[model samples]
Target: MSAGTGQRAAAPGPSTQKPRGIDRVLAFVERAGNALPNPVVLFTVLFGVVAVVSTALALADVSVTVPGTDDTKQITGLLTGAGVRWLVENLVTNFAAFPPIAAVLLMIMAVGVAERAGLLETAMRATLARAPRAFLPYLVALVACQAHMMSDVAAIVLPPLAAVVFKSAGRHPAAGLIGGFACVTAGYAAGFTIGSLDALYTGITQQAVAVLSDTHHADVNILANYFFTAASSLVLGLIGGFLISRVLEPRLPAYTATADAPDASESEDIRLTPAERRGLLCTGLVVAVYAAVVLSLWLPNGAPLRGEGGALVPSPLLTGIVPVLFGGFLLAGVTYGFTVKTLSGSEGVVAAMTDSVKNMSGYVVMMFVAAQVIAVFNWSNLGVLLAVKAAALLKSVGLTGFGALVAFILLVSCLNLVILSGSALWSLIGPVFVPAFMLLGMSPALSQAAFRIGDSATAVITPMNPYVFLLLALLQRYEPEARLGTLISRLAIFVVPFLVAWLGILAVFYGFDLPLGPGAGISLK
Candidate 1:
């Protein structure tokens, strides 16, 4: 099959433009990357490797002392009869109950209603269609940064929306698609406000910390990275806007508008009518009402939403974030649909939900194999073992201060090239990274903040991100010559600006040793 996107092969079309030095290098990189097997196959190979290695290490009697205590964990061989049986018994159940599986699918179902109702698209189109020419790029970047609140749906929705926004302003739709995808992926770990990501990331972190600590609890507040994330979002938007207008916009080769794209003359006329305007207002009111009801539950002492002892941070409200987001979208979508008459009755609602699932079929298939790999890795205790080793090596070198954080960020960045799923990568590394940092006097949130920087900065350049594949296909509509290499060259321009801004944000937090978020500090002490 093709790469992570599961797309069919294409016939050659227009000849490619000759490349210079970096383009040539990136082109070579693209060849090498695409030469590799599909992500599902890659993950399958990874599973086998983990299995073999676990057996070899176990046979060698390899073990490590858990850092905070005297207890030792020996590497368990997945090839052993006991190990194989354990894997067999839990394999199906593990995939069924994988944490991200439930969160992502639920988010899709909820946000799908908003999307299918046309509330999201109409509202965005209305706002961006009227923006000033110079201000449009910055505004799109800003919105892209905050789109994390839309959850997994953000990945599926924002690129096309941004394309329309650009096309409305008489710019290349392909530039909008490429740049929008970059911004959304780079903005994943960072947002103007807390979103579904924080909840999902926090849940994985809690489990990681629980593996090694009794004293230092991971953030119960989903706002753990909010302070850093919000700041980075603004920085990325400003710099991204500048680059988009000057760098990305100029670099795209000329192309005629495809049938899928509206002509320049027609695109300039894109706008919302009165009906859509009313629908947006109704949607806003519905969302507001939903938020008010949810918050009121948390206001009362020992209420259903609050945590133990009437605390808000560690509450069910915090942990049950996925459902809260689900409700908000469901209500907002239905309200907009009814107002606009796009949705008629209960049948329409169900049809909208069904369409959402149809869109997510690819993601669902990918997650199934991913779940199996993660399950086997956890069962083998390889993640813990790797973390213990990493901690020891880092501590021995006396790596501390901002340098330690930088090293960790860089490591994750390199790995992002191969592993595109943020949750999957975090889950694999968190068990090792979190506890190890805690041992070095760093807070779990600090390591997490560092991870956010790494996770986002390189996504634009990586061919492996499934969303990148999605964007590439969209780009090909206008420029049939646009291969992965050409797309990478276009996307690569954003990397330096993104990395510099993200690092600068991290440095501000690191140098001052400031709080990373609500009640979350840079160090445990």
Candidate 2:
């Protein structure tokens, strides 16, 4: 069961010769990303820029005709007295109502208990213990892809644990770290089932779509990209697993554990203890009962979870997904916690929830600035105007249908290198592209699918990704000399193939006219 039995020799050191094209590109990206300000500061700067630009555009009487409507909308300068008053009045409401914040926070609160209770750690150990050595890379990749349901927990926990798993199996821990990070970031938008991310993005998409037209409105269900993303999880798992074993492993130096490195001896004790086993059983029972109760409300005729006339798209289940995540995780976590002595009573559970909230302080600050940016952009009428103008420009150039879709995907992929936050980037561009694509006979869901593909494919290589730095720090535990370039070069090996494969999947979906999810399709009616 040793992963290092037939390991290849280490890759050669960096050449003194001039860097090639891709190396030069990555070096530039690393430098530029390092030079950029923190995301919160960047968003704050963007707010100021938007305000100044809005004033200038308003003074010039800049306007655009709304697509499918006779009315023309003019920019509203946010620096003006009226605009200032509106901003002051709506500041708190803006942050409170930024679609993703509440949903993200709620899910975190619930999943945090499970993470804090050692449930997630136990599960990973038990799963890895039974898996064959030869299949370890693929198994880790697959599990990491499916771990998207747990939100950021997987990204934070899996890399270090994977390093341990591989080190115990006598494999290069750096390769395991690389594999874990690649699957987590590259397959970020793909999952085996709907998760907080789906709810978060769907809300943003709904808001963007509502800006363009209301006549064709149906609820943008949280599962809008379910089938496509679920399929992507499998595709990425296989491809990512292969790249890690065949490509990344050979390139890494043989792992030599340091004092800070995870102890391989600890792997023997990773098995579930008696108490953890009991807690896991109880957690499973709780999840099953909860699922049965929820399904009872949705599966029967004329159920309450189903919306009026039994339409699943507009159902309470889809709209209420965030709360369901909170409840489900809370129930399972509490069950496991109490059984394992991680929670002695209600007070212990409350403490865990409080700690989770404390962990979100940084996110709260970022969202505060992001909210203002979004509100100012919308108030200025820039987003809608940009969409209309862009759509017109594309039509003038005859870039419609599939060509436009591919171009949009590439655009998003390039932007991902500079803009790291998926939600933040979507807020900035979603209004423009979602409506613009709809004008070209595509559905908002399809635009979202393309955007997700682009966003995820480049995530692992982007220095702007906050997780990239974290991954490097983790890598240093095994290979203290590991640098940003090292991780980026390793991850870049998979980025192109991952992008191509995902785009191909989208093409097939479009060609077959398959529904992206329940009541969601590739084209507008």
Candidate 3:
């Protein structure tokens, strides 16, 4: 498969005569992107300063009064202080923790192989190849949201693919960009399949839930939100598509008149080879076998995916789900590559893996900044204070059951702007609220699910979400004039529908007393 984007203006040779209109816009985007503060550097510096100051203040006993609480507590300080070796160790260990990271890596491995083998591109081209031009926006967003399970491919790869797809379909490339990013950002929380953030958040959540509930019980499953998430994915995807086609596309500056650009001007020129096709078939067969095995292990009486009593929805396999997405992508990617001749031997496989890791260099850097910031927040007890204050306010409102859960989600979404990291936020909130809600007869698992929906739904609109900014930087490729507020505002409209749909689904699940994950239910037993 071809890389989904146009390379650097095809070398600016004959066109040095200067650009007009849209070309000028494209040029401005490129220049502005290069000129912006490197997000990585900026975050590192900012986080470092915060960590240092927080650490120093913690040691000096300079404590802030806990909001809404009569008790004062000492900050843990940074993990690096004299008596803080365990804190430092926990940070390092958390960063190095597997399961989630490994899952992401494995999924990408297979997906990269599939991408290299031309499977994804062919599939993308083929899937919507016949879709009516009107449905393109919905299709792009839907596909991009699902693409989250494929690592960071959507952010880096999909928008350009979207532009090319829109162009090939006789539509404006700008519309494609908008549609693609919408899915990537807005669908951030709605993955039906496994995703890295899903794994990370689930893992952290289980630990957090244990803080107040049964410490020995691993009650929160990683895929606790899957079934409902899948349904909403389709809903939001369609909504985003309609909004773009009817509203945003018409208003975009570089509007092309037709639904698709002529095929002759398309950039990638990717075609599936016979071997690649065979490889894809083989990959499908392998997946089928894999699923069968999983079913054998999980669908039989007392299968892991089922609940303690053999209920399908609340299965352990479903809850503690280690999204095999990593492995799935790796296997699919390698299969496609080998079948398509993009990969020749073991050497090719290793190289592809290397390249995949290389692509993540920036993420690694960002993670360090993110890690330090979260570490400091925990050390300062700021996150706990925030969670406690909010939980108290929520309790005092006299709302109960689903109304309370809905309010809790809204509160979490607002808090998301400041906290940004779902796990960190949940780590603070879950202990306080999970059991608190459980006391009110809500399942801890279900509360965890609500927290996730709130966490993800607001990610696209929040400036504090590191990935949102990174995505905007990527968006500049097509819309150089795109501003943060413009992007967020456009996204905000989508969020209203997304939040509505998400809450609606939660209500259905709760009303039915549906299982949220393995041995987990919407209401406490």
**Stretches of candidate 1 exceeding 4 Å from the true structure:** 1-19, 148-181, 193-223, 246-261, 300-302, 358-380, 427-431, 463-490, 513-520
* TM-scores, all models, native as reference: 0.82, 0.89, 0.69
Best model number under TM-score: 2
Every model: Cα RMSD to truth: 4.5, 4.7, 7.7
The TM-score ranking, best first, is 2, 1, 3
Task: Please identify model 2 stretches exceeding 4 Å from their true place.
Answer: 1-23, 169-172, 213-218, 250-262, 473-484
Better of 2 and 3 by lDDT: 2
Q: Which residue pairs come into collision in candidate 1?
A: none
Give the alpha carbon lDDT tens digit for every residue of 1-525 in model 1: 153222223534324544567656645656666776766676678778889998998899988776667777777899999898998898789678766566666766767777778877686677677889888888788777877766656777777777867877778787777777778777778886555467667756665665454344555456678889889899898877887888988877875877755456656445777898899988887788888899899988767888888887667876677788778878888999899998987888888888877876765666677666666656666766776677788878877677888898888988777666677678667777887787677888888888888888887787656677777777766776566767777888887778878988889987898888866888875
Model 3 — TM-score against the truth?
0.69
lDDT by residue for model 3 over 169-236, one digit each (tens)?
77877677666776776677676766666665665555444333321234566666677677768877
Model 1 CA lDDT for position 9: 38
What C-alpha lDDT, on a 0 to 100 scale, does residue 30 get in candidate 2?
A: 68
Q: How many clashes in each structure?
A: 0, 0, 30
TM-score between candidate 2 and the true structure: 0.89
